[model samples]
Target: MAEGDPSYIDYEAFLDPDFSPSSFANTLVTSTNNATDTPLDLSTPLSRVLFDLQEIDTHIHALTTKSALPLLSHTQNQTAAADHILKESGTQVAAVTQGYERLQKEVVQKWEAADEARVAAENSLATVRLARAVSRCLTLGKQLESQVAEITGRSATGAATSVGVDGASPSAGRDGFRALERAAYTILSLREMFSAAAEDEEGYGLDRVKVIRTLRGEFVIPTENMIKSRAQQTINRFSLSSNSANSSNGQSSTSSGYKQARDARARLATAATTLYLLSPEPKSSTTAVDYKPELLLSTLQGYMHTAIMTSVNSLARALSQLPSMDRTLADISTRCQDIVALEASLKTLRPPPHPLLASTPTAETQAAASTNSNLLQPLLHALDTSSLPSYYWRSLASSLTSRVQEIVNRGGVSARTLRSNRDRLRIEIKECVLRASRVSATSLLAEKGRSGTDTVIVGNWEREAAVMVSSVVGPLGR
Candidate 1:
């Protein structure tokens, strides 16, 4: 309202929900006149109040009339929106219910068939695995049979063509060794397969099959035994006597004796390799009674034992007959050379990996078998030395010490002769070491084509020579 007007009203104050008529009247009266003024005229104020009320009512009517159509239109639009939303929600809910029903129906209809298909797939896979296992078993069996036939054929041919007094032919020996190696490889393959099948969950009943059992009993075990026997025989025939004679005569490589010795070594190497392949795995049992040495190691240890015993006996006999000392030393040196040569041959020989082993289920086993193929490592480990020559010499020294002590304890002519030749004994011991080292080096150089200027030294040969001399001379001096 206008400030100059006599009938002005604050219509905005009346719109407040908390507005009170008495409070408004008091404020208006206070704003119009102070308390010191004459009492307010009631008639003028009442008239102005009525006029203000009429003006406020008119403005309210006009505002309501102007907003009527727009309010109706807004209400209708809201109602239509609510109906459309309800219809769309019903349609979506119906579609979802139908989709759920269809999905449940499909699941109920196909559950049994799906289960059957899964089971069939599993059965098919198991059958395939079983077929593969059987195929491998039969293949190994045939290979084993073939190897046996070849070995037998070679043996028969060797027997028929026996021109020598010993009934041995070089070609026959070579062929026999090759056949044995092949047989051993086949047997190993079979054993590995059996082991793998035993560990495999899918390879159920493989070992119990009649054909597998038959092969294992009739062919595998017997062939394995035969190979061991033949290999042991070959190792036993390894003699230093022939080698010593050939060396003493200064025979050329073309000589019959030299060629025979070479052939013998070749056969020995092949046989050793075969034995290694056939050797059983090391047992896990820690008990001494339960533990058994591998076949190859035991055989090699026996060979070393035999050599030691023979040398001790020969040297003891020579101590009595001093004239034989030179010959005995020569023989011992030849034996050392043979040992060196054998060590070289074994180190150089690497057996081919079995083709089937790679395809076997056990990779750790394949790796282990490959590592065990090194023939020299096992012997060296058993002998407890890195150098074979050093082991042999040191072992001989230790063995001869007691023997020489016993002989000198008798105080007879042998003892007197040994005491008189103490200096000569020392010299002879040194010469024996030098001769063995020289000849072994020469043979290795010739075989391997090593540089001529390369010096060959047996590990601590000087100490070994001292040990040998003391073993004999100490007793004499005492």
Candidate 2:
């Protein structure tokens, strides 16, 4: 074939496994001759094919010979370029490796330095917070100490002062109550500070500080105990004096006597308020048996217990005597009146919020404190009764039931009298309940103007009277 010719024989056909040289030759001869004409000679066409193959082979040899030197030069140039690129790449890789190592060392050093600085800053912040906590503890301790001293000084000087006919100097009582309030507030503040420190991570070590420990041991603990003792003594004294006063007065005291009683009640209220302020936060115990109530609540409950015991004993003795039943029931009515008075006083004794106690003073918190301000609420909660009078009568009934049963079990003359006078005993019990209810109702009318008819009683007197009579008469009948 000539160079760049469009028409050419397929050289790939000669390499094909199925290619037949004889069939190709026959086809070529048949294509060259007509069907009815002379048959073409194979030798002539085969000689022409052989000549064309020789010419094609010679052309290929000539072209290869002409291109050999240029191909060799191009290959040599490519190899040199590759060698140069490889050398440059190796040098750059080494430099980059050195740079990376130096950068890694610098970054590691900076990171370590920054980490140490951060740790130091955090430690310093913690130390500062701890110091502030210790300072606050010391401040509260000093305030508590001053308050205790004031209370002590007032107590010491009050005995020498010109006391009222009832033995309490008005000025001294006022000063004593003020000092007690301040001391209670200070104690509460110190307690809250300690509680906050316990919750804070930085201030956790505050209790371990030497001065703090000393303050707690010397001032905090002793002052708390002293205040608690003083308040408790005051309450006990008030309860006793009130009982005696009620017994002597018999609802017919003069105006001056009423004034004295009012003053005594005011003093009692101050002491109760102080105790309420000094009351500890209620803790959740894991079990009911492990639960302990507030100190103020326990004290009030003790008062109620005393009242129950006294009433039970008096009623038991009256049952034995039978003739004194009327007098004994009257005394119980007076005791119930005292209970009503106590409940009213407690309901009215709302302690003002301490400035130090409220950390974040808000309208909502103030309102909540005001709403839950009743000093008697904790006592009521512990007794599980809303009405103190109701609780007292019910508890008396239960105790009196057992006492009556014990007396009847003896089967003596006293028991025989009790069974015979069961109807009279029921009437006296009902009269006592009605009298107590009338007294409470009269007081309420006096305070907030008369409402409804005079015949209407204030509480469930019928039910209470029935309960008391049943407890007493039921045992006697049996």
Candidate 3:
């Protein structure tokens, strides 16, 4: 609006500071600048207060009384914005209060309903248990009465009653279950109680229901005595087998022959298990669970012999094209199987001589001994002769053949005899190894001698030749 408008005042001349037309503006200027020496404009704080008071007093006089400004609905945006903020804040508070009330009421109601259901379920479980208990009591009474009648009905003079439930003889059959009538009854009662305790009022209306419907799914809680009895019976059977093995054969080196070998092994394993159980303390050995030394020895010897006998024949049959060397490799080659199989089957911590091997010696072994004597005769002549170097092969072959002949001709001997025969060959091989230009061939001869006519010899010869081939080629650069 222009300064000349009705609301605009002529205050530009007052800014000249030459004259004051208004008393309020004059008093305000004087009080404000007295000590400060600064300009006190009409708009100063003291002047503003005075002007407002003058305006108020003048209005009061003009209208007799001034009424407060009516609280108007805001036509201006600032007033409307403030009203909008207050209204939104109140609505938010109401929403929050309503949410809190709803959640609290839901939680309290849910807890009460859960408690009621729990109480009902627990009450039903208790009722079921009580009914079962009563049924159990009645069942027990009935069982006792039956037992009493059975006892009373027995004739004291001649008729004899069997133990409790079944007439199974304590002698013919084991388990002595007939004597455990009372305990059996108690078990039945407890089984019933457990069955009832597992159910709720819905399925079992006062009558005890079978909680375990499937017989296959039923629980089996064996008593300590029952477990002990079963274990003892098993143990006794094991002990019998173990004892029998000791007395059977083993008198002859081949006493536990190949025919009865399987039964022997089974009995041996069983006996070992029994002994382990009977032992006051158990060891950590894998076989300690069932290691019977005697049985183990018997089975081991039998298997060893079989292996030696079988391997020799197997190797001979397999390498049919090599028949020229068959007679040489087969005899002892196969028997080496005995030695090897004997060793393989042994699970002991030591490399002891197989008991059977020690006791029983084959015919081949006896021949080896006789051949050794003949071997000494040839060595004397061969060593002294000037043609020894060239004739070494011939001499070695002849000596080996003589040994083989002895082994074939002489029947079986003792274990000591067999070892003695091996010792002779070992010494001859060691001695001839130095004198004989063809040591590899010489060693082969020695093996053949010991192996004799047996297929085992041929097999051993083939293996030894393989090793000899390796040794010879190593130095010759072949």
Top lDDT model: 2
lDDT by residue for model 3 over 1-478, one digit each (tens)?
2223443234455467777557745665677666566654545756566775676566556544333233233345668898999999999999999998898789877888999999999998777666655565445544533432332333324243444355533321332222233333443444434343344422233233343222212322333234224323332232122222332344341232332333322333333232223222223322221223342233333433343344334433322323333343433332332232222122222212211112224566555434433212222232353222222223333334333334334535432243344433343333322222222111121222223221111111332333332322222221
lDDT of 2: 0.71
List runs of model 3 lying over 4 Å from the truth: 1-48, 56-122, 133-222, 236-478
Which lDDT tens digits does candidate 1 get at residues 225-269? 988898887776665345435433433622544456566667777
TM-score of 2: 0.61
Q: Which ten residues in a row have the lowest lDDT in candidate 2?
A: 284-293
Residue 200 lDDT, candidate 1, scale 0-100: 54
For 1-478, candidate 2 gives per-residue lDDT tens digits of 3456543667677779999989887777777666676755667677768886887787778777888899899999999999999999999999999998898789977888999999999899878887888988887777776666555543432343456555655554556655776777778767766655444543467776888778888879888999888877766655322433442343444233444556556766767867767766544312211222267777788888888899999988988898888888888987877677678778887655543332444676556555556777767878899899999889999988888888889988988888888888888898898887755333222322334532225566788888988999888765
**Roughly what TM-score does model 3 have, to 2 decimal places?**
0.24
Q: Which scores greater on TM-score, model 2 or model 3?
A: 2
